[model samples]
Target chain A: MSLDYLTALIAAVLFAAAPLILAALGETISERAGVINLSLDGTVLFAAMVAFAAARATDNPWLGLAAGGLAGAGIAAVLGVFGLLLGASELAVGFVLTLFCRELAYFMGHGQARQPGPDLGALNLPFLSDLPLFGPAIFRQSPVVLLSLVAVGLVWFFLMRTRAGLVVRAVGEAPAAAVARGLAVTRTQFLCCLAGGALGGLAGGLYSLSVKPGWGHPQGCEGAGWIALAIVIFGGWKPVRVALGALFFAAIQVAGIALQDVLPGLSGTLFQIAPFPVMILTLLVVNLRRSAAFREAARRVPLLGRLVPRTAGGAPGAIVGALDKGF
Target chain B: MTGRTSSLARAGFSLALALCVTLAIVAAAGAPPLTTLAVMLDGGLGSGQAVLRTLSALVPLLLCGAALCVTFAANLWNIGVEGQITLGAVCCVWFLRDLGLAGLVPPFLAVPGALAASMVGGAAWALLSGVLRTHGRVHEIFSGLGLNFVAMGVSLWLILGPWKRPGMASMSGTEPLPAALWLPALGGRPMSLWGLILAVAAFVLVAWVLNRTFFGLTLSAVRQNAMAAERLGLRPKRRMLAAMALGGALAGLAGGVLVAGLYHRLIPSISGNYGYTAIMAVLLASGSLRFLPLACLFFAVLTVGSIQLPLALSLDSSLAGVVQGVLVLTLFAARRLWPAGNTGSTGGTRNRGSAA
Candidate 1:
């Protein structure tokens, strides 16, 4: 491919990755706080529709983004109240809400289907746009794309550097210990879930107002939430890694489209279906490090024996640790 | 509050809450809430035809619900029932074409053969997820979700590719199966009497297996404590796989019924969210086999009735899904608030199984 063609592909990948990054990061935060918000797919769909409708009505993209974020937080609040406050099963509530929100979106958004709405366009930075390959690929993008990048850095710094970040990790890792240390476990979790939800809503806005643009029946965002959930696991709940996971997923999607010309017989349907299996495989590999049998098998291999670590690491302690309880 | 009384009160309150919320939504949409609901009821059950349509919808819901009961009792979330149904339909269509039995074989023989193919297809698809859970340490929920996507892709490929119509492929679907292969309809009703009979038989079989068999006891034991079950000489993994296979087979039968009896064509939307809606029905049943039929009918009404919403209120029929979703959420909340004395821990364990 020509340099220009490659750069354009890279840029397209970035734009596509934006929503995934936002949603996955939000999930990372929520899961790290010892809560799994499985309603992400529905939340994103509802938010996208709401965002599009809001933008169409107000003629303001920023308002649409805010509306999307609020919608997400509102849905997440349902999880917070029921799962966290009422001590209901988070998974069951989330699963129900996911289906509910999806249907609700379809019902309310029927009128908005296929209607044109305000969308974010590329904004070239004065200095950065002048740079060669990186400029066009990274700098010459919509504000949402830039914000998504900044979000990666911000989430990382918040989780790794801030005191509140410590509290978040502490609650996720050892809620009882955090409780004993005087941290209000429930409050922290509730706040984290809300924050995570807001991000998810913004991700939805990114989809309707920028990435995919326009709403239609079935909306085409059905699997994005589940992919984001898988990405959180694939990234080991780390912000930077989660961002990379999003980029990697987006790259696969872009590459699939790009390869259609080179390999006509491969079929677009095959390409479309590729990510789910790939994500499932990645999930297995990530979890394998913790499985004793996998570790034993790795030790028997000549090269892998030397490289494989004796101890598994990186999973958010509370989220995966709860698995041991079989709950 | 006494447990039973509290539970009753909570149920009443939640129902009211759901009604209010739904009405508020209807009003916001500029539709008369009471009239809209009346139309929905009329559409779902007003005439004999409407009742028949609802009964037809109940076939898949009941089958899928019964299927889920098998796996859920064993504490496996076979979320891929949606995908399994698709595969079943695909298999049914393929059987009809490849067997070349449209005219050669008798209707009874061809139909049974096609149904068997669907069961095998669904079982095989579900077994893949079961294997992943047992061996690969992957959660069935995620694996099932992934497999669902793969199943959709496969069906799409079949419709748009090799199975495409003679002239050109379209989203409409593959050509209809020959008339001889179609299931016999019931007295000019939209649904087949055979499909209803099959669903009833499946439900009875599931109830019997769960309540009367040693296998059912083993499944419960495994669900409660795999380690304990292992020590007691019961193979938890094997039981799990069996439960999943049984579940998949039933769901596949639902798919087969949809194709042979209802749609008679393998369209992409054939499943119609039946697999997912069945999850809600199963959950609402709360492990009671007797309640399964009622739960299925209730949801069937919501879905079948919602079809009138777009016509009467200018609303999307998907509002039915919204109601179902809210109902499940409300049930979860009520379960927490009331704490049913005997079933409390079962609810707790189910939560943990999915959460982890």
Candidate 2:
């Protein structure tokens, strides 16, 4: 491919990766706070429909985005009320919410299906838009992509450098310890759920208002939520790495479509399912890396030691311990 | 007896709440709520044929629900049941075509042979997920879901590539099996009594094994505390694997019925979301066998009835899913307020505990 073609492909991949980056990071926030938002798949679809309907009715894309964010937060609030407050399992509540929200979206958004609606326009930054390949790929794109980029930086700084981030981590690692330190564990968890859900809603809004740019039955982004959830584990709950995982998945998607053109005989359905097995294999590798045998082998070899980090990151302690204590 | 009455009353109240919420949703969507409900009821059970359709739908639901009961008894999620069903149908179709068509198998043995192949196919698929959870350290939920997608891909490939129809390949699925290969139905009707018999038998077998057999008690013990069960000299992993195998076999049988008894061909969506719906039905029953059949019947009616919604009300057929999901959510919420005074509720609580 020519350099121009390569640049455009790269730009397209980044653009497609924007929503997934937002959703994965949103989930990253929730999981880091010791809550697994399993309703993510349904949340994105519902938010997309709500965003499309609101934007179409009001003729304002930003309002649609806000509505979508509210829709997501509202679902998260239900999860919290049932999970933390009422003593139900968060996983079960989230699972039910997944199916509930999905059907609700389809039932309520039927009329809005395939109807044209307002969408966010591209942002062509002045000097940056005129620069090299970076300009066209990063500067001259949808504002949602910029939001996702900013979100990565903001989430990283918030989780790593801020005092509130420390409290969140402390609560995630040990709710009892955080309680002893006078931090309200439930409140922190509830707030984090809301914040994470809002981000997830924004990601959904970005789809309806920008990326896919319409509401429909399939909506073209049906399983994106599950992909985002998987990306969180692949990123090991780190914001930057999560964003990278999203970008990588988007590339695979684009490559799948591109491969169809080269291999004309193969059915397109084969390519559509390429990411799932890859996802399973990636998860397998990640788990294997943390096994004792792998660490011992790394210790014996100097080169392997550099490749395998001394400390293997794990899930938040609160999640495992909470499971241990039973619902 | 009073506790049973109160539990029944609570169920009635939750059902009423679910109905109100569904009707309110319909009103909000600008449709006449009562009319829609009546139309759905009429569509589902207005005629003898419609009831047959509902009963046919019930066959798969009952099988899958029984399948889940076994896995849930052993405290395994088995989310990959959907994939197991798909693999079963694929194997059934393959068996019918390769052996029956080629005359390698007698006409009398075609149906039974195909069903057996499907059970093996399903059991193997479920075992893959079980092995991943046991040895690879990957959670069953993720592995099961991943395998579901892969299974879907496999079915699609078979439909469009190797097993495509004679003239052209399409999403409609592969060539229909010969008449002799099809499962027998009463008086040439679409509904097969054999499928229903198989489903009921599976449920009865599960109930017996879970309630009376020594293996059943061991499964319950393993579920209560895998660590404690291990210390007691019982092999928890082996029991879990056994439960998954049994569950997969029943689910695979459901798929075989779908192909041989109902659709008469291998389709991309042969499983028809029965596996997921069965999961919901199992949850609604709260791990009790007595309520399992009732839950399956209710869901079956809604599914079979909702097919007519678009024609009658111009509404999407997903209304069925909306109502089913709402009812389950209401029950989940209700359990918080009205904890049943029976082991049924205790079983539900214990299942959630093991989910952690």
TM, every model: 0.96, 0.95
The native-contact fractions of the candidates, in order shown, are 0.57, 0.46
Q: lDDT values of the candidates?
A: 0.85, 0.85
Reference-based lDDT, residue B88, model 1: 91
Give the per-residue lDDT digits (tens) of candidate 2, residues B45-82: 88988899999999999999999999888888878889
Clashes of each: 1, 0
Per-residue alpha-carbon lDDT of candidate 1 for residues A125-152, written as tens digits (9 for 90 to 100): 8998768866888888877778899999
Task: Give the TM-score (vs. native) of candidate 2.
Answer: 0.95
List where candidate 1 sits over 4 angstroms from the true fold: A265-267, A306-311, A321-327, B1-6, B100-107, B340-345, B349-356
Off-target runs (Cα >4 Å) in candidate 2 are A296-307, A321-327, B345-356
